[model samples]
Target: MAEKQIVEQVLAAPSRYVQGKGAIESLGARLSEIGSTPLLVADDVVWGIVEEPLRRGFEEAGLPVTRVGFDSYATAAAVDELVEAIGSGGHDVIAGVGGGSVIDAAKAAGHLAGIRWASVPTAASSDAPTSALSVIYTAEGAFEEYRFFPKNPDLVLMDTQLVAGAPERFLIGGIGDALATWVEARATARAFAGTMVGDRPTRTGTALAKLSWEILWEHALDALEAVRSNTVTPALEAVTEANTLLSGLGFESGGLAAAHAIHNGLTAAPQTHGLTHGEKVNIGTLTQLVLEGAPARDIEDFIVFTTRVGLPNTLTEIGLSPQDTAELRAVAEAATAPGETIHNMPFPVTADAVLDALTTIEAISRRVRAAHGLAEPTPILTP
Candidate 1:
């Protein structure tokens, strides 16, 4: 039995990971070996920030490259643009370098190439870089269904220095997204039990998700300090990796639960449309915990960690008001779609209960934000 388990563990999708300060500079050579003249897809913001270094890397390695710039929107249109750029030119490989948007676009582009992709993330905001799935949005920026592919990334390159140097909000958002792994994975495991697909819910994925949560809970403060101080503390590195790589791979294969479902509900609000992906997911995680009957202490611990890290602890921050009860109800209903996140909860959840949880979550988030002297809650939108 133990031998069977060991054999199963060895069969998971493999990703070549490279981590360090100057790791990004070596990407051209590393990717060139796998495929000459790889297509590079990056958001405009990333190009402005890291283009010079990347250009130098390509020049130094004498690698042929085709660069495609995206506007940092992961919309279907953007994906189409990327595919068009990669074209029928027959590039040997595709590389996505930037945040989740660029990575998602690159992932889709590589899929179009009928080949594996190398993901280079400039921010640790979400797990998009490491997943075989792409959360493509509609052209108008509405949440769309997850797009699954036959394979995961060919490589995951993490330049800790570049990541540490990027805006602190990215890491905070990453933490927000990373926090969902344990919450979501556990919920899925409980719902489907041993029926989890393919070596997915692997003991490794489950263990990584739990450890990611623990690292976030215990070291979030230190991570925030590192971000503020512009230093890569060991805690920050661990948390960053968890958010960018581990959590991503775990959730893609392990499965999602109410946390992401709650995030999906955010699209119902125009105000939430402007928020970062992980930021919305952060609040969703809190709301999911409430639905899961998590203890007050455990939930509070999550709230405190989020509060310290600048994540939304309340819906009011995302622009939902008390009087928006009607809108919240509609959103809750949408979250309970069949085989969706809300249904994945271990306990039964009604739309009304979901509404109440959202209200509680919003209120708590506001209080935590206020106490930390963060942004004030804003008024909600009404027709």
Candidate 2:
């Protein structure tokens, strides 16, 4: 008899997660449990929003806090600078406050410094807060690479009032990100592919992915509507949890297939640089559905939810048209590059498949938009 293949199942998540209105009020005490001294990595914009509450909380807890600034992108040089600051400041823990880039830098810095970190996201823009990996970008804001750590964050604190107060686009973008967890997890499980931890998916991980999916479909629209009115409704709370905790756990443990790989590939086109990570990921998810030959109803349902949430359902909305063949091909090539998660598909994938799926999604999105009486956006990078 042939020897059986031994496949291990792995799951990863932050040690602790707290979410609610005024959750930042306890940031100091919560962080103190991890370490006494904390260094905050946040940009000026985020500092403007969170400074008073965070500082007051830390002061009330009698914990000394140091601060550092990060702009929009998490560059390697930025990580190095933060590592230096942590060392020189004798800081025991890190508090990353802002969007994905700022938090990603804090995670990378804390990992390098051999200290734990807390994620305090002001906006629900992406799922970078709870993952062990950081998406590094060029200083000019192009994709560079990912920096991974041996472990996830020590804690993740989301102040939903703060999130609800931010632009509704941020919440919608997070929904774009969380929407992929189940689709990709389903793909990975069917293929028996490895996850971020370099092992197969666990039943627990897959379950979380499915849960994330159901939560989004149920509550995403209500959450966006609540955010539009700057209210912390229960829908917003549930979507926030789905976007950060469940999506983070789901993607890391359940595995990524083509959606995120395609997001990375979209980065190769300078035309796409202006788009947000979740915006591009949404289109990539649609393209992935096409590449995998998903049911027509599934594809249409995805487009409906995506458009209703004000996310881009077509590549045309971001940039590029089939007329820009060279760039689209470049995107396809990058997506299928060796070691990309596109290979995690149940069946083999080719650059041609990726390229064709790209154009196909654009066509389908146009039809859906017409049905909804929404006009197609002008191609942003048309020659």
Candidate 3:
């Protein structure tokens, strides 16, 4: 808000950025630019989807290649396994191919190996590819801490065909993740108005993050429908990029807040073990708005929109039972840490407030489910 604070936010760094339908084809050359070999990392399902085309591309470029597979995202265990595989495999360049988890693993492994890396996401999930940061998890898949880097991916790639074939849930989750940047960034800027942290968000960062949110809100419903129908409409493509690329940059450069805090709370609940990052964040975003004292009608609108698109709208939708009150309360309490999501809140947040919001959300969520007569809806949602 003050001139001094504005200056502090401008010092943040972001790296090279690129996107489009056929951008993946250039990865080989980009890898060359970064002096990286073609060491590909992907989830098991990814190979079944685009393995031949990718292998053929590297072969056509005459680049030596090595392959590594993971059972899940870039968890500590997966990273450990990849380190071993890469050590033995003698791969120099790393390419991440899949959704956020696969790309995240690739980035972490590539960084750990001290080699250049590229990213090829088959689903529009999170901005895991382009950022110079990684959300690390324990071997058992619990949140660890944020790992920041000086540089982002050496190369970034995407194939609309691959993304189009992904389940609609990924697109929905990605959109939710993307949209949170603007809301959270604004909240962060507001909180920093006269604080000791000063403002850590530049005008450019705030504007870009805001614009990304506007774009997502404008296209999300249509994009969700197109994704569900298995049709890659222009709207869907635009929204996907906005969420994955634009939002990723926004959160990293602009700063994140409570929605992300709530997302982090997922690790505290065993019942939420199978949730996707975006799915958890989707619900978390709603809770963040509630904690912000957002307009009741607007909060309800978000609830309906996310619910319609099959994003997780409730604790139950993401696999936690309404019966797990104590665990949920604990998570809410933990989420209110000063360094956690509270920094993004417009005012200093109390654990009691977070708990109240969480409680309210369960009521709203159950009411919505009742309207749809989706009785005995499976207590757990598939990630």
Candidate 4:
């Protein structure tokens, strides 16, 4: 048998990112730089907020525009519908405006239609804006699979004012999503896992991941406060960039590990239905630390950071009861399933190991909360 060759490294990012208070107002000009005839896709709520400005801007720029409404999940059917619409209209560019689902649908549609695409995020909810990937779910909202595109979006435009005005939960959810970047990337580097970008982790990706983590720890609280007040402060801007741009590039080029895999596994439990992706990943991040036997100081620091920013540190917070052995085992099994990203860990991880980590993390979280004089720990049911 011959030894297999390993590719060295890969890095991927959007062609450009423009972010500020009035970034959306420049959408027409940005589109003109790429194509003259563009199609806009957004959900009802997003369309309501952005319609006038977008229409005015495109008209002023003398660009032809076609608008479509996306009100369903990012299923293959939805993408196909958008693709047909774009093809029939002879639109040259695709612009997605809204949250993760809307942006993902537009990206998949544009990829299928062979058109350049742009992402305009209305909230800082997840790191889905800058990546060259889309997560397709069943129409019923169950996890299906991730689809990778040939190239990243041509543009990612974020209006900080819009992001700030979004519900605070979305911002915190974004923080939780960004929170796992450094931890997972470090594990991926140690395991020598391939990134979503298709090769080994790049120095640039790892550096960005580290920077994202540092910014979250330094500015997350202030940013949360700023968003609550509907004000765009420097801290808010930094965290938004960290959660969207840096985390997007970092995760795509650096790779994913146990945290995200655990998140996927958690979806198997119906109790987690109400939790956001970042909220679930928040618990997965802590669970990963426990699985890796991370140093106590490091674990405590993360617990403190999550607690300060109102991220879920225990299973109960995410709607899982500790005593549900069968459900917990299912989650663990899913996490360790074949082809799951949990394999990206530096060491071999088993379902049993993940189960044990889940229990231990609950105990650790309780202790940390008690020591901090925060709310009393929820009673853990012995398995």
Which model scores highest in TM-score?
Answer: 2
Q: Which of 3 and 4 is ahead in lDDT?
A: 4
The digit string of per-residue lDDT tens for model 4 on 289-371 reads: 99998999999988877887878888777667679899999999988999888999999999999999987787898899888
Q: Write the per-residue lDDT of candidate 2 for residues 1-383, one digit (tens) a residue.
A: 99998889988889999999999888998998999889998888888888899889999899986888887578899999999999999998998998888899899999999999989999787877989999998877767787778899999999999999988778888989989989999999999999987899998998998999999999999998888898999999999999989998999999999999999998888888777788889988998999989998899888887887888877678877767789889989999999899899999999999999897777898898788777675653444
All candidates: CA RMSD (Å):
4.2, 2.0, 3.8, 2.7
Candidate 1 has an lDDT of 0.75
Residue ranges of candidate 1 with Cα displaced over 4 Å: 1-14, 193-200, 363-383
Worst 10 residues of 2 by lDDT: 374-383
Candidate with the larger TM-score of 2 and 4: 2
lDDT of each: 0.75, 0.88, 0.72, 0.88
The better candidate by TM-score, 1 or 4, is 4
Among all windows of ten consecutive residues in candidate 4, which has the lowest summed lDDT? 374-383
Q: How does residue 312 of candidate 2 score in lDDT? A: 89
Candidate 2 error regions (>4 Å): 1-6, 378-383
